[model samples]
Target: MRTGVPLRQESLVTPLRLPSLIGCALSLALAAGAAFAQTGTPALPPADEREPIRLLVGLPPGSGVDRISRVFAEALSQRLFRPVNVENRTGARGNVAGEELARSTPDGNTLGVVTATTMILNRHLSRQMGYDPQADLTPISRFASLPLLVLGGPGQGVRTIGELIEVLKARPSTCGTPGAGTAQHLALELLIRSVGARCDFVHFRGIAGALPELLDGGVQVYVEAAVIGLPLVREGRVRLLAVTSRVRSALLPETPTVAETVAGYEAETWLALMGPRGLADSVLVKLEAAAIAVARDAAVVRRLRALSAEPIGGTRTELAATIRAQDSIWGPVARAAGVTAD
Candidate 1:
């Protein structure tokens, strides 16, 4: 049996508990090998294809997104019969890597995981961008939904949303988030505004950067992502006050939703597979198939859910619709918060 611990560089589906996915992929690989050995079949990886594909990540190495991308890339290499390499560009809240993907050759050789925040919300939040997200990229598929949380700092004793609100109303508090225009920032702002509480937001380049302040009481609360925050909560370093999803998280069923206290407040974010605009339909189709298959890999789903990221192996059409749908939700939030690129 596989370990159920998914994601490594070379082979993600193996050593993980995804029997069906591994069996199917191995069958396809074996069948392709046999086709070339016995009869006059077209074979699996076409004779003419040999170039490696590159996946651009907009975060530092070892970040959850980077690790997640490597998992998908390794699996895709198997399906496409090409080496898939992950490259980290890391800056501008993912815009740095996004620009690289936008400018890369679109002949299926280059693709990227553009955070949904960068694609949908940056249009309103960033005053200076190197490229237009919609015009510069082609949708492949959406693979994950990262849930956000309202985390209370140590010594606060603000264990619930109501207690947190009482403290917010009693005195000005500092709220921290990874970046200025991130879903966490907006969601944190929404919570304060909705509860009629007062707080000033402190923006850091990443959640790790703000951890010291939060633990020291310099920052009272933080909008943390479950991928990284769950470990902190489990370690007793921080308290999870509430989940920012519209509904309570399955991982913490007893935890209340921020919406339950304030109403209509959600700040969920996600990542999607994309290639530069003008990509050939054939290449897009191949990428889409590989991404969807890897996302639905039973092991990937289990590991992701454990981290509070719901796996969604949606199609290109679905991703495009999501792009269209998010403008209405986050645009107003960004405007109301008066957030802009820093």
Candidate 2:
């Protein structure tokens, strides 16, 4: 989202400062980088000695996740004393990039910034996936948590979740999802199942492509990231029926959570950093420290807040546990709904 400097070689060493506390912590990251580099083979270059760290996103260039990841990547590179390069390896509902990351060397040089689909939903939806998310990846940290918004075009008669339910019950309505195995798709499926509402689902390559249908009334509803839906809602081009987060979104506090209507109904999309499985413990520790530092930076917090995202930084163990819990909770629901890879 920012285009300033071309990410100079010195900027990596130049501190990416936050307001106050963040600056102090990132100084520690610089110290750690120095210490970590020295403790290892001096012949082995500084973390900056390697080419830019490749941060892969499984989605295409213009996707919300891609845009957000690029912002963080740019910021983190400036903070972590290394160039951060973001690449889009798009295909297979993000399975292609997941597979590539899972297969990449575990040197902490190649990391993946992917959504919940690469780690959780894909596992539930397909058994023939090429890589094992848990077995083949090392969780670095999570930087953002995004809620899903239910959107409708004008004349849909769906001013509220209640009205949306009424409209769907009166006639079979169609909802569009970004991809077949995405949190957007599954969240809609969960809602339909919980409310016992019969509706059809339309799968688009991604949210940008799907929004057109909602704008034109080609689809009655869309479940997508708030970052994408907020602008439309603000423009009066679309109506936000509800947010799937249990709590009201900071971006649209006026909109109630779907959980308010259907208790126990909540879902969200998350973006996290992960590396190839078997990443060295030392390298993993350094990478995790860098990620934690980035997420806690005041500037990072401000940027994510603008997008209605909450920053979360934790140990790899915590991320793994989260993935496990999510998998357990959604597996049966996905199966019962007959969700599968497209």
Candidate of highest TM-score:
1
Runs of candidate 2 exceeding 4 Å displacement: 1-51, 169-171, 204-219
| Winning candidate number (lDDT) | 1
Q: In order, what lDDT does every prediction score?
A: 0.84, 0.82
Q: Tell me how far the alpha carbon of residue 278 in candidate 2 is from the true structure, in angstroms, after superposition.
A: 1.0
Q: What is the alpha-carbon lDDT of model 1 when measured against the actual structure?
A: 0.84
Residue 112 of model 2, lDDT score: 94
Q: Candidate 2: worst 10 consecutive residues by lDDT? A: 41-50
What TM-score, computed on C-alpha atoms, does each candidate reach?
Answer: 0.79, 0.78
True-vs-predicted CA distance for residue 13, candidate 2, Å: 40
Relative to the unseen true structure, what is the C-alpha lDDT of residue 10 in candidate 1, on a scale of 0 to 100? 92
Provide the lDDT at 175 for model 1: 87
Q: What would the per-residue lDDT of candidate 1 be over residues 1-342, giving only the tens digit for each residue? A: 767876666964555468877998999999888977888555467755658888899999988888777777887787778899999998988899889999998788888988977798888888899899988999999998888878877776678988888989889989898877778888887788788888888988877788888788889889888988889988988888998887877677988988898867777888899999999988889889988998899887777776567778999999999888777877887998887875
